[model samples]
Target: MPDSVLYSAELPAFDRATGQLSLAAHHLISAPLSFLDLSPPGSTLLFDQPPAHPYQQPVLVDDQPRRKRRRTALPSADASPADFAALRDKRDRQTTTDRESDEHHAGIALDLRAALEAVQQGWAGRARDEGWVGARDDARVQWRLREAQDERPELDLVGLAAAQERQTVETPVRLEPPRAHLSAAQLFNRLVLNDSSSSSTTVDVGIETSRVEPAPPALAALLFPPRSGFLMSDLSTWSAPSSGIAALGHAKGGWDVVVIDPPWPNASASRSSSYETFDAYDLWNLDLPALLGDKPALVAVWLTNRVKFRRLVKDKLFASWRIKGTAEWWWVKVAADTGEPVWPLDATHRRCYEGLLVGHYIPPGTKNVALPTIPQGKVFLSTPVGHSRKPVILDLLRPYLPSPERAPNVLELFARMTLAGPRAPSIDPLPPPEEGKAGTPPRCGFYLAVGNEAVKFNVLEREGGAVRGWIRQSGLEKAEAAACVPEGQDVERM
Candidate 1:
């Protein structure tokens, strides 16, 4: 029997109620930290049965006492000091020799080179049986490296410094706040119009709205506060809006969870340029705790297999944010056809798995209540979708949420897609009340805000007792057109 255990199983079922997936069902192989002999001791030897023999004669022997050995006396007081020193030196040398000998025998070294070669041979044989293509060099190493760097422009430090200086000088001035007692609609109008003279203008919100660029669809609610719904956006360039802060403050107990997939920088990532990369310092400086609200919530961060990055997250990032890391789950990428690891388990360049680090946010003086423990080392098996596109693990995370009753105020930072789909629609105006009956305002739905200003807004709105969606021109063009419309005209509906 083999000493290590290799587990292979089916993927877990998804939980629709909580929108979480289980990590326990995936195939995972674990070995002992140190090698162990699984067989019974002395079982390797064969013993022949003794030939059937008869009786033996007994003989009487006389009992005699053996002489006792006498103990040596201690060195005499008159003995020379040099003699004592020599004796001590000899003993020390003997002890050192014994230690070295013990170390040599105690160290158990196993040569897995033969085993690895056998595995490779078996893999090759299996590939042949399965009619799969054998491994081959896809590209020349030298050419590949050169081609990756072809588009990278040479840096100019002097020009960059001058540009920074110019930006600092040209930064927009802060706007004053609107007057007190303004209604929500009035406040929204002032913020959207960039009313600089209003007495209630917040510097952060003002700067956010001053630019003609349209914010992400997810950030629409944050820029223009909504009663309720979901929101998703990328934090590549923009800071957290004031309305988002206020909304979180007013939430039942704040957001129930916040999942962040930071664009962690790496050499391979720089070559691909799939998304913008952020330095460790930039990720560390993000205000994650403020997004969680007043109540305790679960924080999950997706991580790569880099030891240094993992250390930064555990020792520095989470520590600074007052979040105690609880468990780590593995996302094992398997071959789509074979349902096996994409690469060998011990591949030198890449591992077959990535890690998800889960932590809990505990404020000071709060009761340190024990949360539902999630099993660590469980495998989340899934086939690769696209470059760095992770499958939604919200189903697996729902069980550990702070509140499981209602949909937890979930937020995904650095999000490229929402649970619904990519590119959420823009803000829709509530329909007018019906005749002879009080028309309650339509329940707000999920919101997704993007960072790019060029994408058109397909805002989902309520109209004529049904939900209707319309695609409007980008906010930059729409705002310009709105300025020329008659004061009483509804330019948004038009």
Candidate 2:
């Protein structure tokens, strides 16, 4: 979180003219990290090392023709050569292939090749010249090996009673959410208001909202560990008859922008076991449309490159949700050290990049409206952060907000960390509707929202030894003042 270095060094620089933002993923993730020591004693800090290759496409051992083996790991005792032949027959008759999915997804990348190329050569070039880092520290491996020694081995037999006591759990950082029976809505409100709640801890961005009065100093951006976001929250409460979601529809107003990163089921993500995945059908329970009421919205969703997800969003999800497809943005991941794509752009299987599908949500019966166009094929290039983590995107999305003059209500569903900056103002005692002030609750409902997975990543730091949303002492406020304040102005001149 070298906030001072973020904009000044020009790595995370955004050329307002060209609509590109480039910076190392760690710079964004490091914003709140004041001081942290996660490695076991005598271990090297993993953050100092370069990020390794994102993923290497596995070589298919079965691709080459193989001779029959005397004893193969058979599926069952009754397995026979006929069953093997049947499998080959089924494969021969299958019309669909993973290659087809690759081609369809590659089509998307090909369409945006020029745009992404331009950004890479231009803005990313400028960032590299200005010294933006390509990668940063990650200690996942070191942490895993060291943490194991801290455990009491089951091998301690009765005869081994003379053995030394097990290692004390000195670093008690938790990698999982604490069990709590608190209401998700209440927990969210406590976070927004910076109030203490059952979550026990809060991660606040010490920045002022777009408030009319002199703003309070931004709160300490600490740690958040609640598990209410989409990953593992008991979702029944979100849609129950007596739940706050019903109130969200009427009491709260509509959001300006909604960003959702649903934990869609995937073979890779499932195998990684990073967090819980949800069935596609579970999304309906979120009542996402209800959060929008009548407001026109800029919807940004993070999607995997799989064709199933792309089709789900384009063919079925959008139609049922009344969200009109508008544009697509690709978050191209490159290496921090070499500043190149982690995997080849032409590589088909195990592709390195992810998609951020941008769309518009307008309630039924709304007409004669004007909305800002989302730049098609926008490219956001940064090194990959941890699993399922994305760079901070509030600034890039600012242009398309329903109310672009200032901040608008934004909801980040399935958010890993509470976004690390100024949020839309929340006035508990709303201004009278007749007054027509900005704080007046909208007729629709809560415009912007985030899921309960807020603290999921807080635990990631504990388990993997990689910090998320922590920053260096160069505070964002300092960055803003240095960038905006006059060079010769005295402290009180303004």
Candidate 3:
């Protein structure tokens, strides 16, 4: 019989609920491409075999081994300094692996060449889309150089500075935040009208009035009726009146869940006085209508700390979306060693937590879904902070995800570039056809969990065509034979 224990022993899955660890689910999601270190690991396993395999099985190997995990070998008194250096290098390598594992529960890598090409194309496309011609050619060149690492690994700051210096004209700043006194309503109107002309706006409310309106019809139709009368916008975009007020009016279809992460413009250090920040209006202006335009759903917004943003989200954003209050979930990220802020012997710094405010966009005269009430008893557990930290909505919130998995669509409005690995394909918000050119598609499409965004995947071969032995990627010298998929077997892009 073929070895059932297929693939390498690199992947491991941990079940926090049962305190169990087992082999990761694996099938064809494996690729030889090396992602220069940014992609999330795609689903490393699949449910192809019978469910008879022992899952959640933990090995009791060295259950209580007396050896210390962080032990250093002391040098002999007569040992040379070089001997100590050699031993230290070996120890460092071992220690770093452990740290990396703890940091990345699900590790994934992307092909370096593919990643570089993506970056180059990503910058170039954005520049073209935004009419930023001055930066396109130079940016692509710089990226190529960086990818090759011919001379330097750092981005060519000098070339960029030179290109920027060559620009003869200056961009006009017309829509500065209003200096004169303006009522909240007028300020809101100006913001909505001036979004395209200017990238930044601030609303200074004077004598705020209760001008909240009803949810939009399009939004209501998309979601099943909510328990309350409003929908809250995510924190970053909750500043606009349109963002956090009652829905604009009814929508088309009803929804079960809405996940939003607004991009409140985070200004990096060393920037000028003002920069582009995504206000509530910018985020919700298009999507709110699109989402509520379809279905009424339970909505979840990830938020950072900011008192003004918070109040706007709760009172204004939620009210506008027509999503009523449900419950709040706090996502706490703590290092394994450093328990909490008040704990002693804490080594890590700048550990912060986020909040996931859950609400529902209810429609008028709609009945609420009845279910058993389960208290969130001790739901305040903590985990380590992963990059691009969002609540691990899988365990508690998986039920909200669409089941029967037929082209289940999801959208992340304010997403960064796609990460590789298990959650990769599903995390984006565009569809395969619209993601890229007809032939040159993005690899992120291989991540299959999401469908609403512009996603691109390699067509290893035309559907129903003869199978080959290997596949050829870009930057390669010759065409490779395609992997042979058994007759009628699904050959998903890895």
Which is better, 2 or 3, measured by lDDT?
Answer: 2
Residue lDDT tens for model 1, 1-494: 11122333433434444577764433322111001121111111111111111111123346554443222223569989986887677557755445443342232111112222233343444544431111112110001121233343212212222333221111212222321122112212011212211011111111133354664222211111121122222342223444253243333335556677776787767997655566766775576666554577788889866666666786788887778746666666555234355654444345656778887887666686766665444454544434565555655565676654334445556554322211111145547768886543221112222221101111212123121112212222112101111112233532
lDDT of 1 at 401: 68
lDDT of 1 at 126: 50
Better of 1 and 2 by lDDT: 2
For candidate 3, the C-alpha RMSD (Å) to the true structure equals: 21.2
- Once model 3 is optimally superposed onto the true structure by TM-score, how far is the C-alpha of residue 120 displaced, in angstroms? 43
Model 1, poorest ten-residue lDDT window? 33-42
Q: Which candidate should be chosen as best, given TM-score against the real structure?
A: 2
Decreasing lDDT order of the candidates: 2, 1, 3
Tell me how candidate 1 scores on lDDT. 0.39
After superposing candidate 2 on the true structure, give the runs of residues whose Cα lies further than 4 Å from its correct spot. Answer: 1-100, 123-232, 239-241, 245-253, 420-452, 458-494
Quote the lDDT for 441 in model 2.
23
TM-score of each: 0.44, 0.56, 0.33
Write model 3 residue lDDT over 32-126, tens digit each, in one string. Answer: 11111112111111001111112222345678535333234577899999979988886677654455532422221112122222323433433
* Off by more than 4 A, model 3: 1-256, 265-277, 280-290, 336-351, 371-387, 400-408, 417-494
Of 2 and 3, the candidate ranking higher by TM-score = 2
